[model samples]
Target: MRLVPLDIDRDLGLVHAWVTHPRSHFWGMQDAGPDRVRAEYRRIAENPHHHAWLGLDDDGTPLFLAETYDPAHSELAAHYPVRPGDLGMHVLVAPPTTPRSGVTSAVMRTVLDFCFADPRVERVVVEPDVRNAAIARKNAEAGFVEERQIELHDKVARLSFCTRGAYEMSTPHLSPAAIEHAHRRLIAKALAEFSHERLIEPVPDGDGYRFGELTFRARRFPLEHWVVDPHSLRGPLDALGFIAGLRETLGIPEKLLGTYLEEISATLAGAAWKHHHRRETAEELVHADFQAIEAAMTEGHPGFVANNGRIGFGLRDHEAYAPEAGRPVRLRWVAIRKSESLFVSARPEEDHYRDELGDETLDRFERKLRSEGLDPGDYRYLPVHPWQWEHKIAVTFAPDVARRAIVPLDAGLDRYRAQQSIRTFFNVDRPDRDYVKTAIAVQNMGFLRGLSPRYMRATPPINEWVAELVSGDDELRACGFGVLRERAAIGYTGDAYHRTGTSSAYTKMLAALWRESPVPMLAAGERLSTMASLLHRDRWGDALVTALIKASGQTPAGWVAAYLRAYLRPVVHCLLAHDLAFMPHGENLILVLENHVPRRVFMKDIGEEVAVMNDRPLPPAVARIRIDVTDEIKELALFTDVFDGFLRHLAGILDVDGVLPADEFWGLVRDCVRGHAADHPALAGRLDLFRPTFRHSCLNRLQLRDTLQMVDLTDQAGSLIFAGTLDNPIAS
Candidate 1:
C-alpha cells in the first residue's frame, strides 16, 4: 500500500459509494450525494490544519480514504487537553468488492507510516464513530490506545492515538505465550476481586485459592503491597466461562448474565488492544502528561476484574467514546414536556440553567418549538449523550417525538469535553457553566451508566445538604474541602405511549443534572485538575506527583500530607462527623492546585455516589440520601473505596517510581485519620468506629454478577458483597 493524494473530483465517485454503504455508519455520509462528498473532501484539502489522502494498493487502485488534521484546529472543540505535537486523523476503508484478507490492515499500516513520515508529528489521533468495531480493532493493530468517546457535530467518535514508536513495534498476531499471560492475568484478577466480594470463595486446591472449580488449580507469587499480582497466575484461565459458571453461585439473574459476559469480553479486548504495542515502562509514564499517562492506565480499577466492560460499545464504540479516548463531545439536546418531566433547581428559580443556555440559545430553541406548533414554556430542555440520542432515543422514544412530547433539538452551543466518566461533560468553551451529567444507556462497569430519572428528583437537596454541611463546618472549611453541588436536575418520565416499561435504560433515557463548576470556586492563584490526573505521568516517566512536590518545595511525605489534608482528611471527616461518605476515587474528585501543588478538594457526582448510612434524617428532600447497611458494610465506603481502591493503586505507582515508599505512604494516611480524630474531640466516639484494619470489600463481584443493575439505588450499602479481609497497612 502507498500514499496517494485523494483528488476530490476524481475520487468523489468511488468515495461516495463506499461512504454511503450501510456498513459505513460512522462516516455519516449515508445521505450525501456525489457533490456533497466532493465538497467535504475539498474542505479538508483547503484547511491548513487538515489534509486528504488515499491509500493505494500495489495495483495502483485506491483502497481507503484518509484525512489527517491538527486536533487543536479541528471541530473536536478541545474536548481533550490539547498538547503540542498532536495530530488528528480519520479513515474509511473502501468496502470490499470481493472476499479479501488483510486488505484493511494493510491500508491502516500504510496510513500510519504516511502520518509518521512527518518528523514533527509526535502522535496520530483519530475518532471513528463509536460503533465501528472493525476499524477499532484495526486501530489497535496499528498500535493505537483507545482514549475516550468524543462528540463531534454529527456522531460520537471513539478517540484514539498512536506514537511512531508504538506503531513501529506493532504486531498483527499474539503468540501463545502472550495469550496465556493475558488469560491468566484476567482470571487472576477475577479470582481476587470476586472472592473479595463474597460472590465466590476460592478453596485451597494444591497451592492456590480456587473458585467454582479447581482452576483454583493455580498458584505462585505472594502478595505485593496487600494486593494480588496478576502476572503470577497459572491455571485454567477462561475468564468468561469462569464468570458464567458462577452465575448461580454469584446469584445474578440470567438476563444480566449475558450483559455481564459482554462486558468481560470488552475488558479482555482492551487488554488485547494494548497487547500489540510495545509496553511503556512505568518510569516513563510517571513523567508523561495528558494522553501519555492516560495510555499507561491499561489496568482500569485494580479491585475490579472487568473494569472496562463497556458492553453496548463494540471495538469502534470503545475507540470513539470511552473516557480514556479523551475526545471532546457536544451533547445533543431535547425539550421534554413539563408534565412528563421534572426539573429541580438549586439556584433561585431556574436562572442557573437559564443563564447557562444563553438567551440567544433559548430564543433559538423557542423559535424551533414555536415553528413545530409547541410552547417552549411547557418543556424542560435536557442534554442527552449524543450516543444515547442517536442509538436509543431516536428509535426507542420515537412515539413521544411523534406526539411532540419530546422534541429533538440541535446540539448545545458550547463545546464541552468529557470528564473521566463518559457521560459527564465540562464545558471547555464556557468553563464557568455548570457541568452537565447526561444519561448514557450504554452499560459499562456495573449497571447501565444512566442518570436515574427517579433519583434526579432528590439530587439537588442531597447536594445542597452536603454543601451546606461543608460550608457550615468551620473545621471542614479550614481543611479546604468543597462540595460541588448538583445545581439542577431534569428528566422525562415519558408520555403514556412511551411509558412502555421502567427498565433501567428507559427510565434513564432522558435525564440530565448540572453540577456546579469548580472554576468559580478556585482561588486567585489556583487552577483545576481532576484528582485522577494526579496519577498521570508524562511520556518521560516523570510523576505529576513528583512534579508537584518539587514545585511546592516539599518533601514527598509533606506533599502527600498536604494531599491527604485536602482529599483524604475530608473523606474521614464526612464519615466520622456526619455519617456521610463520598466516593473518593480519582474520577469523582477534583483537586484545586497552586502551581501544580495541592490546595483543596472538590467532591462531585452527588446524585448517586453520596450516601448516608443511618436513617436519622429530618428534611424529606434530603431523606433519600440515607441507605440501610450494617456497621460492618459502612466501613467499605472508607476502607475498601478510599484506601484499598484508590490509595493502594496510587501507592503502587509512587513506590514503583521510587518517589515514595510504601510504608511511609500508609503511615501518612494513618496520620491523617488519627489527626482528624484528635482535632475533633466531639467525634472521638464516631472516629473509633473506623478501624485501621477491616475486611476486604469487592467491587468487581457486583459487576461480574450483574452488569445491567449491580446495586439497588434504594439500598446502596445493603447491596455490597464482601469476603475475606486485608491486613490494613494503616493499622496502628
Candidate 2:
C-alpha cells in the first residue's frame, strides 16, 4: 500500500463514501450527508498540523484513510510530554470490498513509512479503542509496542508507539519511495488545484471563498496565496498588503485555472462547508497552542505547576494577628498548599522543641503529645477560637515550651480531632476487599449516617472479611451470600441506592462497619442479585454485565446464584437492547446452588459471551431493530467504553487477571465475532468491526478472500433464516 496525500477535491466523493458507509458508525459519521462530508473535507484540507492520506494498494485501490497528527499539534500535547519529532497517527481502514488478508498490515506499513520519512520524525504513536484487537494486533505486527493505556474521550485506548528504527526494521519489504511518490502525487494535485483557483479571484475575501458563508470569519492572513505561488518585483508592502497583492502578481495558465475552479464546485454547493472550514481551522489552532497558552499562566509565578500538580501560595494578613490570650487570635499568614502527593510524603519536624532533643527523644515527645490529646500530625494550625489556645497551652506544659514549639500552638484541638476521626472512618484496613464491597454497596445502597449504630452492632471484623474477599478462589455462592447479607442489612437494594446522593458516602461507612462488625453475616441470595442488578443499571448495559461478572467471582455462590436468577433477565435484556458487547468467560459466571439450573445460567466467564458474537447473527428479532450497520458499530464503540470502566472498577477488587487480561478478553471477542459470522452472511464483508489479528497478517489475499466469503455465508444464512421466521423483518 502507498500513502497518497488526500486531494479533497478529487477524493471528496470517496472519503464521503467511506465515512458514511454502514460500518463507519463507530466514527459517528454514518448519518452524515454530502453537505457534512464536504464541510469536513474542506476543513481537513486547510489544516496544516494534520495530514490525511488515502492508503492505496499496488493496484491503486483505496484501502484505508490514514490520518496523522503531531501530538505537538493535537490537544493531547497538553497532557503528554511531546517530543518535537513525535507524530500521532490514526488509521481507519475503508471497509474492504472483500476480506483481503494482510491488507491492514500493508496499510499500516505504508502509513508508518510515510511518517518516518522525515528524519525529524523519531516516533509514531497511535491510540486505538482498547476493544479493537484487530487494530491493536496489526499495530503490534507493524512494530508498534503497547504502551500504557490511556483514557481518551471517556474510553480506554491502547496507546501504542513505534520508533523510527523499529518501523524500518520490522517491515523489510516496504518501499518508502513508493509511498512518498504516491503522497507527492496527491499533494501536488491538491497544491496545483489550490494554486489555480487562487489565480482567478486570487484574493479571497469572506464573500468569495468556497464555504465562506459557513466560516466564522474570513481567513486572516491568506498565507497560502503568498507562499504557494509567489510573484515578485513589487515587494515593499507590509505583511497584509503583500499578502493581498500576491493575487495580482501571480498568474495561472488558463487551462489549469478552469480545473481549479471546477474542483471546488462541490464544496461551494453546500453552506455547511463554508462554516466547517473556519471552525476546523479554529479547532486546529486551539489544539496546537493549548499547551503554550496553559504554560503562560505560570509566566510570573515562582515555578511551573505541571498539569494536575499542585500550586502553593501564602497570604499573610498581619492585621488579623492578636497578642491577647482571652480574645480569639488570628494569624496574619494564610497559606495555600497543593502537591501531587503521588510520590511525595509530608513529614513534620519538631526541631524547635522546648529544649534540645534527639530523634529518640522527639519520638517519645510525640507519643506523649498523643497521650495528652495533642495530634503531632496536625498540619493546619490556625487557631479559630480562644479555647483552642488553652488546649494548646495545656499540651505544651509551659509558656516557654509553647513558645519554642516549631509547629503552631494556637491550632484548634477540636478541629484536629474531627479531622482524624473522619480520616479514620474512611481508611480501609483491608483495602482490596473492603474497598470493593463498600464501593459496590454504596453504589447499590444510599448512605445514611444513622446506619453507624446498626453496623457497629452486627458487622464482622474488617480484616477477616477483606482476606476472604481477596483470596480470589472463593466459591461464587459463598461470595454472593456475603455481599447480599451486608447490602440487605444496610437497606441497599440495588440501583435504587445509586439514585441517592449519599451513595459514595454510605459506601465508605459500610467499609468501616464491615471491618468493625463482631459477627459476619451472609446475605440472602435475592438481596445479592438485587444489588448486582442495581449496579449494572447505573451506566451502560455492558458495564453492568462486566461488573456482575466481577461481583460473581468475588462473592459467595449462594448469593451470586440467587442474584443472577433474580436479576439476569434485566441485565440480559439491557445488553440485547443496547447491542452491548462483552467478554463472557467462564470465570465471569457464578454457579448457582440450584441443581436444576443450567451450567451456563451462572456463567462467570466473560470470554464465552465474546465468542458467541463471532460470525453470529443477531437473533432475528434483535437484528430487525438493530439493522442499521452504523448504529451497531456505534454501539460496539460504546461497549469499548463500558468494558474499560468495568476493568477500572475491578482493578480495585481483583488481582492482575481481573484488572486487565487484554489478550484473553480480546480473544474471546474475536471468537464471538467469528462464530457469529459462521451463521450469518450479512456480516461477511464487514472488516470495519473486527480489526485483523497479527497472525492474520500472514494470510495470502486469496485465503483471506475465501475466509471472508465463508463467514459472510454463515452470517447471511443465520440472519436470513431468523428473519424468515419473523413476522416483520427490517430492511438494511
Candidate 3:
C-alpha cells in the first residue's frame, strides 16, 4: 500500500469522477465539477492542519482517497470535547473497478495505519454521515468508539474515535477455524430453533439426527443440546444449502423464501463480521460493566436459530445499527402534533420526562414548534431511529414530513446503544434516564419491528400495575426482583395511514416509548446484564455463565441456586400467585449482579408480554394483560418460555462445560421450585396446578408459516404453534 500526494492538475478527471459519483455521498461533493474539485483540493493543500492523499496498491492502481486533519481544528471541533493528540480522517474508496471482495476493508486498514503512524497522534477521529453504515461498520471493526453524532455542515455525522491502544489490539484477521466455529455455532442454533419451530422435524437416527422427507436428506451428528459440530455436519458447512435441503419439506413459498434468504444472508454476514471483534475470554467479558458486556456480545437469540436475521438492513446498516455491531447512535427526534399523537406516562406529568429532557433540549423542541407557528401544547416529541427516518419515513413517509405534521430534528446530544431487540435503545450517555424504544420499519427475524400506535396506550398502565405489585408484595420483595418500568410512550397516527387502517406498517411506523432504565436503579457495586449473556461462548470456549460462577468463587450449583433464588422464584411467584407470566425470554429479562452473583432481576418489555393465565378480575386499565389462554396451555408459560426456552439452553451450556451435570442442575432447579412452594403455603390452592412436565411449544413455527407478520400484537397468544411434549427438567 502507498500514499501519493493528490495531483490538482493531472488527477482532476479521475478524481472528479470519483468524488461526484453516486457512491461518494460521504465526500459531500456529488455535484462538484472539475473546477470545484480543484478548489477543494487546493484548499486542502493550503490548510496546515489538513492533508489529502491518494492510496494505491502494489501495481499502482488507485485504491482510495484519504484526508487527515487535526480534529481540534476541523468541523468536528465544536461537537466533541476535543483532546490533544486527536486526528480527523476522511476516506472515499474508488468504487470497486472489479469484483474485489475485501478491497474496502483492506484500504481502510491501511489508511488507519497511516493515520496512526504519526508519533504525535494518540487517537484517530472521523465523522462519517450517520446513515453511512458501511464506513461506520468498518470504523467499529477498526476499534473505533462511536462518541455520538455532530452536525457537519451538510450532514449529521456519526462521531467516532480509535485510541492507539485499542487500534493496536483490535479487529484481528479471522483464522479459518474461527470462521468455522462461528458457522457451526450459528448452524447448531438454526437446527435447534428451526426444528423447535417445526419448519422441519428432525428425528433422532441412532446417535445422530435427520430432517427432510426421504427424497431430500438433511442430517447431522449434533452434540449435547443439538449444537451442530461443524466436523459432524453430513454435507458442506452450508447455511444456504441447509435452507435448500429444507425448502420443499418446509413448504416455503418462493417469494417469501427469497426474502428469508436475504435475511439469512444478513445473518451469515453477521457471523463473518464477528470475526473482526475481539475474541475475549468469558472471564474478561464477565468483568466489564452492563453496556460494555452488551456491546461485547456477538450472537443474538439462543432459541430462535436465525436470531441475527435483520432483513431491512443492507450490509452497511448492519454495521452501524445492529446491536452486534456495537456502534453508538445519536437518535433523531421529531415533534408530532398532540391531536394526531398519543402520549402516556406512569409517572406524574412534569416528573416523567422534563427532568431528563432538560431545559436546553426542551427549549430546542419548543423552538422547533414555534418555528412552525405551532403551540408546544399541541405537540409531543418522539425519538426516531436515524435509519428509519432516512430509509423509510423520509422516502416512504415523505408526505407526513412535507405536511409538517412530523418535524425533523437532526440527531444530537444523547448517545444510545441498540439492545438485542434492535429497535430498543438504551441511553448509555444518561444511564439513569428512560430507554427509548423507537419504531424502525426494518424486517428483523419474522417481524417488521415497528412500535404500534394502538399499543402505546396500555404500556405505561401495565408497567404501573407490575411495579406497584412488586413494590407492594412482601413475597416479591423477599425475592429481590424488580421491574424496569416503561414510564412513558408516544405514537403518531399519521394521516397517510389513517384511511389505510391500523394493521399496516404505515400506522405502526412512527411510535416510541421511554422505558425506565435499569442503570439508575442499580445499587452500589451492583452491575446489570441481559440474562441471554449467560449462553454466549467466546471463540476460546469460555461460557459467560461459567466466568460469572468463577467470579463469585462459588461452586456451579451454589451459584445457580443463588441465581434461581432471584430469577426463577419471582417468575414462578408471578405465575402461581398472580396468574401472570412475562414473555420471560433471555432478552426480555435482566439480571442484576453483585460480585458476579445474580442478586436480583429487573423484568421489562412489559404490557404486551405480561399474560394472565387464569380467569381473573382486572381493572379496565390493567385488563390488557389478560389473555384467553386455557388451563391446559397456561403452564407452558413456565414450561415453554422459562424452562424449555431459557433454562434448557443454559443447562446445555453448564452441562457441556462440566460446571454441573444435567441431573444435578435439574435437581437444583427442582429444589428451588419446591423450596418456593414450601415457603408459599398460603397460595397452595393456586400453586397446586403447577408441575414439571409440559407440552413442547414450537416458536419458529409462527414465523415459518408467516414471515411477513410473525405475531399479531393484539391476538398475541392466539397465534401459538405447538408440537409434541418434553419432560420438564425441574420436577419435584
Candidate 4:
C-alpha cells in the first residue's frame, strides 16, 4: 500500500469516513460531519511532528490508516520516555473488511519502514489496549516486545517497544526505502486538496489573524456575521435582512430569542439570514467560509473551523456562558481556530446539553466532519471533556475494566467427566487400553498434586482416600473403595480427578501411587514391575524383573540374568542387559517421585518402610537402589510437591477469598517440608535434587513473582550440614 501525507481537502473526507466508521470507534473518533473532518485534516496537515496517511493495497484500494506522532511534540511526551528521534505510531484497517490474515503485520511493517527510514529515528513505541490481543499479537509479529503494562491516559494499555536494533535484527529483509515511498505517496495525496489563504487583518487580543470573516486565536475564536437562511443573497446587507426575517419568523418567544440574537450580533458585525437552495448546502457554505478564515490566520495554516450544521464560532478568551434559565445557547455556532486545540471544557451543565443533542446527531456530525478529511481530535464540538480530548489518541490504550465471562473450573471439570465417560465406554477393550490407563493414572496423580492443593488444605479428601487404599490398611482401603464405588455408581466423580486424563492427573496419580503403594518398602519392587508390565507391553518384563531383584536386595548376577531372560521377551532382555541395567536408579527414582507424589504425603507413614530397608543387609547395589528410591520420594514430597503445591493453592485461595495472606501459608509449607527433610538424610538428598527442578518449573508456570513468593532455600544445605547429616545416616 502507498503511504502518503494527508491532504486536508481531498483526503479529509476519506480520513473522516475511516474515523467515523464503526471500526474507528476504537481509534477514538466519534461520528462527525464533513466540515469537522476538514478542520481535523487542516490541523494535521499543518503539523510538522505528526504524520498520517492512507495505506493502499497492491490493487490500489485503500487498505489501512497509518499515523505517526513525534512523542516530543505530543502530550504523550510527558508520560513516555521520549528518545530524540523516536516516534509513536498506530495502524488501523478500514471497514467493510477488518485486517485479514497478515494485513496488520503488513501495515505495521510499512509504518516501521516510514518511521525507521529516518536515520535519526531510533525506536518506535506502541501502546495498545491490553484486551486488544489481536493488535498486541500483530505488534509482536512486527518485532515489538512487551516492555510493561502501564496505565496510560486513564486506560490500561500494554506498552510495547521496538528498538532500531531489535527491529533490524528481527526484520532484516524489510525495506526502509519502500516504506518511505508509501508514506510520501499518502502525504502527497492528503496535501493535494488542501486550501491555503492569506489573512485579511490582525485578529484582536493577539489572537493571530482573521481570514475572510473568521478570526483565529489560541484555544478559541469568534464567529463573524455569518448567515444561514434559505431566502437571502450572498451579500452582507442580504445576510442582515435574513437575520431580521429569522427573528420575526421564529417569534423569538419575546424572551429567549432576543438575547440570542443580541449575542450573535455582538460577536458578528451584522446578523443575517440568507437563503440557500438547501439547508445542508447553506451550512456547508458557511463552514467553508470559516475554514478559509482559519487557514489564513494560523502561522503555518495549522487550523480550520468546523460548522457542520452549527452556525456560530467559539468565543475567544471567554468561558462558555451558563445561562440561568432560557433556551440553550448554541455552541454549535462556535468554531475552533486550531484543529489541535483542546475544546471548551465539557462542564456538567454543558454535558446535559450535549447529551440532549442525542448520539445520532453527534455521530452524524462527527462522521460528516471526518468524511471531509478531519481527525476527530481536531474538532472541538465533541461532548468529551477537555481532559478526555487531550489524551484522545492514547485513550484506546486504556484498560477495559469490563470483566470477561469466564467458564468456572467446575464447568470444565464437568465437561472433562463427560468426555472421559464416552472414551471409557467406547475404548474398554482397545489394544492401547493399558497404555491409556497408565497414562490416565499418571495424569491423575499430577492433577491431584497440582489442582487439589488449590481446592483444599492438607491432602484433598479424594487424595486422602487414594492414599488410604495404596497404604494397604484394611479399614481405610475398604472405606476408600466404598467411596470410589459410590462415586462411580452415581456417575459423580466429585471433580473428575480420574476422568479427563490430563498431564497433571498423570503426574499426580503416578506420584501418589508410587509413594503410598504398599507392595514394597519402595514402589520399585516386584509388584510395581508386574503392574508396569501389564500397563505397557514394550517395557513390561524387564521392568518387572528389575524391580524383583531390587526388592530382593540381590545384585544382578548369573542366576538373576537368567531369570530376567526367562521372564522377559528376547528383545527386552537384550535391551535391558545392555542399556538399562547399568543406568543409575537416582534418575529413574527422581522421575517416579515426580510422577507419584501428591501435594502432601505423610512422613510418618513412609518412615516405617525406610526403617525396614535400613535394617536389611542387601548387596551394595541393591542397598544403594533402596536408599536412592526412598530418599528421592521423601525429598520430592517435602520440597517439590509440598512447596509448589502450597504456593499454587495459596494463589487460588487468594483469588477466591480476597483477604488471605499467601505468605503465611507458604511459610507454613516451607517450615513443614524443611523440618521433615532435615530429620531424614535420605529425604534431604531427594529434596536437594528436586529443589532446582521445582524452582525452574515454578518459574515457568507463574509468570509474575508477586503471584507466588519464593522461599530462601539457599542456606538449607548448610543447615543440614551443621546438623551433621549425611547421605545415608543409618549407615554411619
Candidate 5:
C-alpha cells in the first residue's frame, strides 16, 4: 500500500461518495455534496497544519482516505493537553465493494505508519466518535489508550493517544526479524532454565559456560539460579534443535519428544509475538493499570522454559485469546441439565446467578430454554470459553445437545481479558465483577487446562474454609493479606465421558468457576498489579521492580522489605499457623500497590491449588485441600515453591537490575522468616524454614517425563521429580 496526496480534481467523486454514504454518518458529512467535499479538501490541502492523503494499492486504486494535522492547531488541543510532537490523524476505509477480513485494520496501521514515518511525530492523537465501537477496538489494537471523553461541537468524542513505540509494538509484523529476535530470547531462556533445573549442566569455560554445542556467560545465584546473559549466547539459536539435542540428557520420553519440541516451537512463536509487542519501558509500566500490567507481562512462568505452549491455539486464536494479545473476550454461555451438572457456591445459587447474569439476561436465557421445550429450572447456566464451545463441545458433545442436555445460550454482557494464568479472566467491562475462569482444553505448561467436574463440587467449600482460616488468623489480617475466594463453580458432565470412568481431559471439559475480584477490596488511591510484574523486565532490560521502587520514593531495601511484609509474611504465617500453603507464585497473587509500593497481596486460584500439608480434621466438602506428606517435605511449600520457584527469579532480577544485591535480598528474606518465627513462637519449629538444604524439585523434569500428564493432582509430592538439593539461601 502506498499513500498518495489526495488529488482534489481526480479523487473528488470517490471522496464525496464515501463521506456522503449513510454508513459514514459518524464522519459527520452525509449532507456534503461533491463541491462541498472538494472545497473541504482544498482548504485542508491549503492549510499549513493540515493535510489529506489517499491510500492506494499496487495498482494505484484508492482504498482509503486519511487526514493528518497538528493537534496543537486543531479542536483536540482545547480538550486535552497537547504535547509538542503530537500528530492528529483520522482514517476512513472506502465503503467495501466486498467485505474483507482485515482491510480496515490494514488501512489503520498504514495511516499510523505514515504518521510515524516522520521522526518529529512522537505520538499520534485520535478523536473518534464515542459510538464508533468498531473503530474503538481498532484503536485499542493499534495501542491507542483512551484519555478522556470530550463533548465536541458535533459529536461526543473519545480522545486517545498512541506513541510511536506503542504503534510499532501493537502491529508487530511477523517478519524474519521478529522470528530471529524470538529465537535468541527463547534460546537464552532454555539454556538458563534447563541449566537451573540441572537437566544439562554447563561447565566453566573462558568467560562463559560450555554445554554440548552452546556457550553462554551466566552469573550463578543462590538456589542454582543461572542468569544467562542473552547477548553472550553462542549456539544454533534454534529452539527445536536446542531441545531435541538435549533430549537424552533431559530424559524426555521418545513418545513425547515430538510434542515437547512442538511446545518449544510454540513458545518461541509466542515469545516473538510478545517481543514485538509491549514497547512500554519498565518505568512507564510502574503506573499502568491492572489489565495493562497483565497484558504487558512477557514471561509466562519464570521457572518453566516452555511456559507458553498454548498447543491448540492457531494464529487467529492467539490474537483472540492469548493474554499478551490484550483482546477483550465475551464468555459463551451454555445451559446444562441439572442432573448432569453440579453447581456449588458459597451464596445461594439463584442470587449468585442473578448478580452475575442480571435479571434481564436470566429471563432471556429462560425464554431460550423454554423455546427449546426444556424447563428452565431443570438446567443450570455455565459459562464456556468461546474457543472450547466451538472446537470441543459443539462437536464432541453433539449427542448431549441432541438430548437437550447441553443447550447453547448467548454470550454474557461483560467483556473480560484473559489473565496471565491463561485460564482465568479479569472482567474488563466491570472491574468489580467476579473473574470467570473457564476450561479451554488447551495444553499449557505441563497440563491440559480443564476443570474437573468432581473437583468443581468442592471448590466453593474449600474456598470458604480458606477464607475462614485467613479471617480468624490475626497475623494474616495484620499484614492485610486475603484470598480472592472461588465463590462459585459449575461443571457439566456429558453422558459419554461420564460413563468412561477414565481420567482424561475429555472428562474435565466444560466447567467454569467465578472467583471474587480484588478490585472491590482495594481502597481509594490504591491500585492492583499482578505480583508477576515485580519480576518483569522490559525489552531494554529495565526491571519493573526497580522502577516501582523509584516511584515509591523508597530505597531498594525498604521497598523489598515492604513487599515481603505484604507477600512473604502472610505466606510464612499461613504455613506456620495453619500448615496451609498455596501456589503462591507471582501469577497466583495480586499485589495492591499504594503509591507504587506493595501494601497487601490477594492470593487467588484457590480450590485446586491450596494444599494443607498437615493431617488436620476438616469438613467433608473441604477435605480435598488436605494432603499427606512427610514432615521433612512439608516446608518444600516454602522452600521449593516460594523460595526456589518465585523469589529466586525475583532476586536475580533485582540483582541484575542493580537496584539491590542478591545477598542483601536474601538477608531481607531471612529477616522476614525470623520475624514470622518470632511472632509465632509456638509454631516456629512446625516446619524447618531455616533448613540448611532443601530438595531441588525440578519442574521441567516432570514435564519431560510426561508432557501430557505431568503431575498427579491428588499426590503432588509423589509426582515431583527431585534431582538433588540446593543450599538454602535464607537459612540462618
Candidate 6:
C-alpha cells in the first residue's frame, strides 16, 4: 500500500462516497451533498496546516482516505499540549465492497507511518468520536494512548497520541547493522559479567586486558564491576563465536552449552531489534509517559547477559506480546470447575472480575458457560496468556477439557500491554484497572515464566501483610513508599497434573493475579516511570538519568541525593529496621516523578520476592515470605541485589555519560543509608549497609549453572551461587 496526495477534483466523488456511507456515520459528513463535500476538500486544500491523502493499492486503486494536520494549528491545540513535533492524523477505510480481514488496521498503520515519514514529526495525534469503539480499538492497535474525552466543535472526541518509538515498537523487524551493533554490546556485557563472576580473568595487555582472543579496556569498580568500553573493544563481533571460544573457561556444562547459546542468540536478536526500531532519545524520553519510557528501554536486566531469552515466542508472538514491542493484547479466558480451582482475594466482598471485565463482558461469559450445559456458579473464570492457552493448555490439558473440568472461553475485551517483567501486564485500555500477571510457560532468564498455583493461594495475603507494613511504618510512608498489592488471584489445576504432585510448569500453567495499579495513586501533575529507565541509554550512549537530571533543574549532586532518598532510603529502612528484604531491582520498582525527578517509589512482585530475614512471627497465610538467613547472607540483599545488580549498572551509565562519577553516586547512597541509621540508633549496627567488604553473589553464575529453575524460591538462601568477597563502594 502507498499514500498519495488527495486531489479534490479527481477524488471528490470517491471521498464523498466513503464519508456518506451508513458505516461512516462517525465521519460526520453523512448529510453533506457532493458540492458541500467538494467545498470541504477545497477548504482543506487551502489550509497549509491540513492535508489529505489517498491510500492506493498496488494497482493504483484508492482503498482508503487519510488526512494529516498540525495539532498546534488545528482545533486540537485547545484540548491538549501540542509539542513542536506533534502531527494530527485521521483515517477512514472505504467501506469494503468485499470484506477484508485486516484492511482497516493496515490502513491505520500506513497513515501513521506516512505522518512519521517526515523526520520533524515525533508524535501522531488522533481525535475519533468517543462512541466510535471500532476506531478506538484500531487506534490502540497502532500504539495510540487515549488521553481523555474532549468536547470538540463537531462531537465528543477521544483524544489520543502515538509516539514514533511506540509505533516502531508495535511493528519491529531485524536489521543486519542492528544485529552487529547489538552483538558487540552483548559480547562486551558477557566479558564484563563473566569477569566479575570470576569465570574468566582477563590478563593485562598493552593498554587494555586480553581474554582469549578478545581484548578491551575497562574501568574496575569497587565491587569488581567491569565497565567495558564497547568501541574500545578489539574482538570478533560474533557473540556465539566468542562464547564458544571460552566455553571451557566459562565452565558452562557441555550438555547445556547449546541451550545457553540459544539464549544468547535470542538475547542478541531482541537487543538488535530494540536498537533498530527504538527512536526515542534520552532527552525526549525524559518527558515521556510511563508506558512510553517502558517501551523505549533498550536494555533488559543490567546484570544478566541473557536477559531477553523468551524461548517459546515466535516472531509473531514477539510482535504481539513482547514488552519492547508495545503491542496491546487481550488475555484468553477459561472457566474451571470451582471444585478444582482456587480463587483467593484480599477483599472477598469486591467482585474483581466484575470490576475488570465489566457487566456486559461478565454477562457474555456467563452466557457462554450456560450455553455449554454447565451452571455458571459451578465454574470460576481464570485468565491465561493467549500463547499459553494455545501452546500448552489446549494440548496438554485436553483430557480436562473433554471431561468438562475446563471450558475455553473467549478473550477479554480490555487491552493490556506487556510489562518489562514478561509475565506481568499493564491495563493500557483502562489505566486504573489492576495489573493482570499471567502464566506463560516461556523460559526467560533462568526459569519458565509461570505462576505457581501453590503460591497463588498465599499471594493476596502476603501482599496484604506487606502493604500493611509499608503503610504503618513512618519511614516508608514518609518517602511515599508503597507496594502494589496483589489483591486477587485465581489458579486452575488440571486433575491429571494435580494427581502427579509435581511442581513443574504443567502445574503452574493456568494461574493469574491482579495487582493494584499505580495510576490511582497519582495526585495532580505527578507521573509514573519504571525505575529501570533510569539506567537506560539511547543509541548515542546518552543516559536517561542524565537527561532526567538536566530536566529537573537541580544540581547533579542534589538530584542524585533526591533519588537516593526516594528509592534507597526506603530499601535500607525495610532491611535494617524491619528485617525485611526485597528484590528491589529496577524492574521491580516504579518511580513517581514530579518535574522529572523521583519523588517516591512503588514496589511490585511482592509475594514471590519479599523475604523476612529474621525469625519474625507471622500469620500462617503470610508465612511463606519468611526466609531464614544469617546476618551476612541478609546483607547480600542490599550489596548483591541492590548495589551490585542494579546500582553498579546505573553508576556505570552516569560515569560513562560524565553526569556523575561512581564515587559521588555511591557516597550519596551512603548518606541516605546513614541518615536512616541515625533515625533508629537501636537498629544501626544490625546489618551494615557500609562495610569494608561483602560476598559477591553471582547472578550469571546461577543462570550458567542451570539454565532452568536456577534458584529454588523456597530455599533462596541456599540456592545462591556466590564468589569471593569484594570491597564495598559505600564504605568509608
TM-score of each: 0.70, 0.24, 0.76, 0.24, 0.80, 0.80
lDDT of 1 by residue, 1-732 (tens): 677878888877888898999878677889898888888888888888888887776447878888888888877647887778788888888888854444566567667777888888888888887887888888887799988898878788888889878887665545465555556667866665555455656667565554554444432211123334455555567778877888887776887777777777777766655443325544443334333344345456656676777667655455446655444567888988989888888665447556878888888889999999888888878888888888888888888898988899899888776665767887767778888888887777776787767778888988888888889988789989988999888888865423666555667777888888888887687877667766654333455666666667778888898889999888888887778888788877877877556779888887678888776754899887777777676777788788777787678667766778877888888888888878987876763444545776567666655666778877766677666676667666
Provide the lowest-lDDT 10-residue window in model 2: 298-307
> What range of 10 consecutive residues in model 5 has the weakest lDDT sum?
98-107
At residue 173, give the lDDT of candidate 4.
20
**Best first by TM-score, ranked:** 5, 6, 3, 1, 2, 4
- Score each candidate by Cα lDDT: 0.73, 0.34, 0.77, 0.32, 0.87, 0.86
Which ranges of candidate 3 are over 4 A from the true structure?
A: 1-181, 194-224, 347-353, 685-692
lDDT of 5 by residue, 1-732 (tens): 679899889989999999898888899999998889999999999999999999995346789989999988988878988888899999988887843334676578678878888999999999999999999988997889998899989999999999988876674436577777778778888788888887777889998898878788889899988888887878777778878877888899999998888888888888777766556688878878899789888788888888899999887688779898777788999999999888888688899999898999999999999998889999899999899999999998889988889999999998899998788898887889999999988998888899988878999999999999998988899999999999999998766887788867888888999999988998999999999998898877788988999889999999999999999999988887888889999999999999999999999888889988877899999888888888767788888889998999999988888888999999999999998888789988888888899889999888899888899998888999888899999877
| Superposed model 2: Cα runs more than 4 Å off | 171-732
Prediction 2 TM-score vs. true = 0.24
**What's the TM for model 4?**
0.24
Tens digits of per-residue lDDT, candidate 6, 385-450, equal: 999999998998888988889999999998888999888999988999999999999989988998
RMSD of each: 13.4, 30.2, 13.1, 37.9, 12.0, 12.4
Q: Select the stronger candidate by TM-score from 2 and 5.
A: 5
> In candidate 3, what residue range of length 10 has the lowest lDDT sum?
214-223
| Candidate 6 Cα errors over 4 Å, as ranges | 1-172
